[model samples]
Target: MMAGTPSRNELHEQNRLSWNEATKAHNSHKGDQAKFFREGGSTLFPEEIELLGDITGLSLVHLQCNAGQDTLSLARLGAIVTGVDISDEAIAFAQKLSQESGISANFDRADIFDWFEETATAGKQFDIAFSSYGAVCWISDLNLWAKGISNILKTGGRFVVVDFHPVAMIFDTDWSHKFSYYSRNRKCTQ
Candidate 1:
């Protein structure tokens, strides 16, 4: 809480609005998710599949599941999957994709910070908390994100995060080592 900074609610609302717009743009630009699934395509990479290693009958929670492509893929692999995203458009598209793909999954539109409490109130817990590229950067507070994951997971649960190094993205900017690269504990603005 800063003297004049936007509140968490305000930040969430801002993110929601931006992601809602991004969903429309993504759905339009990216090849149809439903079409890809209907044609036997999976949004999951081989490494994630190997890491997940047989999710049959397991409960999975996908945080920042943009359009639920990977979430539905997990469902197709027999995991009871629930996806949470900040964008209503993304959730709606995911629901439609589920219907079109004839796969079963649940989609929720909520900020990641509220995920644990919301799912807890619904009496839902999961065996895994999954996220992939581009999701971690959306998190302004890592502690809250960690707490959310912890609260949502059952015993022996796993948290799987697969993404490019943030430093690599920095390199993508100007190909220079001007900025100091550090480990995860310290926070750095991009």
Candidate 2:
């Protein structure tokens, strides 16, 4: 391997550790998750909710589903939901949330890439594959991500991604932007 190239196992482990660390803060005072659920507020943003219109009875897989608030929301919306996350802590928390909220769901602890293969092999394609808000940045290869989406989705399935613009990553610490936005067909690089 090249000096900076991580083996797949190493990459997965690194991300898993990072997400495990983040889970506490993400589910606690730093986030509105508790308030949202307690007050019956939606965890999903308006754009995502609009995109996921009328998911009643649809089978949906939520990729990179950290803590699974959105996944639980989808279940409450009447979709059969499966939430996949890399962090075991996140999956556990999601399962706990499902139980507390009385919303039915399946939570899987696996890397996004592996989840796709597992589902595909099990012949468990879904009507929708969804992710939102900073999830894609954790993926090392967008091509593999796209292929995974294809592998586990039915022919007419919808895939929705609601995330910050990739260009946001280009800004400096002082917020002095450097790149002029332009149209290009290119994979994002970190």
Candidate 3:
């Protein structure tokens, strides 16, 4: 490591701040999420629905669940759901959404790695561990993330990640090829 280089935790803190800002911007574009959920709307895609068939009665933990639309959707399907995120703003909004929608879900504001450790130390385990689109790009260490998933899951518990293909990152928003497929730059910008 080089001197004055940000450590992993420092990088995570930076990302957390970015996400706090991003969450507010992201939610602003989605109108009346609480009302949508209350009227039985879901943010889940059809593929995820099929992959997670019959989640009823399952204990599920949603990692990096920003604003928790999907987590609340899972709860509507009868799963006991807990949503965890690094951004305080996201968790706050998720809690408010859950309350307004009358959905039963637990929202925790903590880094996913720390939350996993705490949940494991408390002997808590879940039947399903889930994360979706736009979640993995913020994860600096997939190995640690995998270990955390393992720690928080019961035997035979399923871990599901639905995300964009790695090749998708090679293209810019303008649909032009811009980045190397193997780019590992610590910082990504829009």
Candidate 4:
């Protein structure tokens, strides 16, 4: 099993470390959102979306949302969506582009761990909570992640996660082993 997740302090530090020049990249991607969404734009894939059935009238919270693409996409689907991410610059760009596209959403900046811990709520919560494609490997605590989702989710709320495990191999067996281990090691895990 993997190690226990780092403390909130450590995660915050790492979030900062990971965001260097990331703003520039997110900003550039905003230019191509139209083309991007035509492809994927972090939204639900056609198959997984079908599994969601109808989200036409639910309140949803999207965590670690990059550039707010998926969050806005959900809003387009009629879910009241909020986008949260650790990158301040990314959140800002998300807001700007969202406004540009006439999509309305609340965007906030905070580490997911810290945000969940700090945002106290009463009996109310979102109808659904989601994170896709770009979550998971960014953190180390699946238990805590589940707990946080549970906290912000209403009774029987649905939580969806879509992402690839960095360590997952299509075929790691000896059969048809064509690539060198060194090549896989040199590939970008993120």
Instruction: Point to the candidate with the largest TM-score.
Output: 3
Worst 10 residues of 3 by lDDT: 181-190
Tens digit of per-residue lDDT, candidate 4, span 1-190: 2388455566566665566357766566446675564453545678657756688888888888867877888887788888888877778777876877677788888777667776544444788888887577565456787888888888888888777765443345765655454332332211
Model 1, which residues run further than 4 Å from truth? 171-190
Question: What is every candidate's alpha-carbon RMSD to the true fold?
Answer: 3.1, 3.6, 1.9, 6.0
At residue 156, candidate 3 shows an lDDT of: 97
lDDT of 1 at 111: 78
TM-score between candidate 3 and the true structure: 0.95
lDDT of 3 by residue, 80-187 (tens): 999999999999999999999999999999988788889999999999999999888778778888999999999999998899987888888999998888756536
Q: How far is candidate 3 from the true structure (C-alpha RMSD, Å)?
A: 1.9
Candidates 3 and 4, the one with greater TM-score: 3
- Which candidate model has the greater TM-score, 2 or 4? 2
TM-score leaderboard ranking: 3, 1, 2, 4
Error of 1 at 11 (Å): 1.2
The regions of model 3 sitting more than 4 angstroms off are 188-190
**Per model, how many backbone clashes are there?**
0, 0, 0, 1
List where candidate 2 sits over 4 angstroms from the true fold: 30-39, 177-190
TM-score of each: 0.87, 0.86, 0.95, 0.74
A best-first ranking of the candidates according to their lDDT comes to 3, 1, 2, 4
